[model samples]
Target: MTNDELQQLAAGLANCGKALLRMADVLMEKKEDAPAAAEQKEPEKKLTLEDVRRVAADKARQGHMEEVRQLIQKFGADKLSGVDAARYPAMMKELEAMGNDE
Candidate 1:
């Protein structure tokens, strides 16, 4: 890539990183401010199966399964040990079914 093209790509990445950081900050603030948030949450009881399914589906729709799998592999199943990895069979099935759907 030309220097100008590389510079533009770098700038775009920086902007994206900044946006992600802003989102993280907002999440942190909410967690700190909401004392009852944890108690009121049902996911705490069993972890949100729907959220996991949605995340897998979203990643599949976005053609990012490889990235998602890589993240899981890197993080290890133990990292999310509370979650039942067996339940993800459906997510993977859905992801496979969505191959090239995008």
Candidate 2:
């Protein structure tokens, strides 16, 4: 190839190398951000019967037995065990709120 053609080919290769480097940098940034994004989107922990029972027991120990019974009745359950498992989250929120009321 002519000298001018060879120099132009080398320059083109350099440009291509720079472009690939920029793309690599961008990909690295995304790789670093992925974990944080996943952490933010993670689902909240699921509530369990024992979890609700623990909170209720705590409230009752704090002398809120009557309030606890009222909360259970509000959910259409005559007792804690009678309350549906699906209601555990709402029940936990109310139970936590009871502590905050103090």
Query: What lDDT would candidate 1 get against the real structure?
Result: 0.64
User: Clashing residue pairs, candidate 1?
Assistant: none
Clashes of each: 0, 0
lDDT of 2 by residue, 36-91 (tens): 98788668688888899999999999999999999999999998999999999999
Backbone clash pairs for candidate 2 read none
Scanning candidate 2 in windows of ten residues, the lowest lDDT window is 38-47
- What's the TM-score of every candidate structure? 0.35, 0.64
Predicted structure with the largest lDDT when compared to the true one = 2
- 1-102: candidate 1 lDDT, tens digit per residue: 899999999999999999999999999999898987756756433325576657665875687767656545544553323346665554455455554554
Superposed by TM-score, candidate 1 places the C-alpha of residue 98 at a distance from the truth, in angstroms, of 57
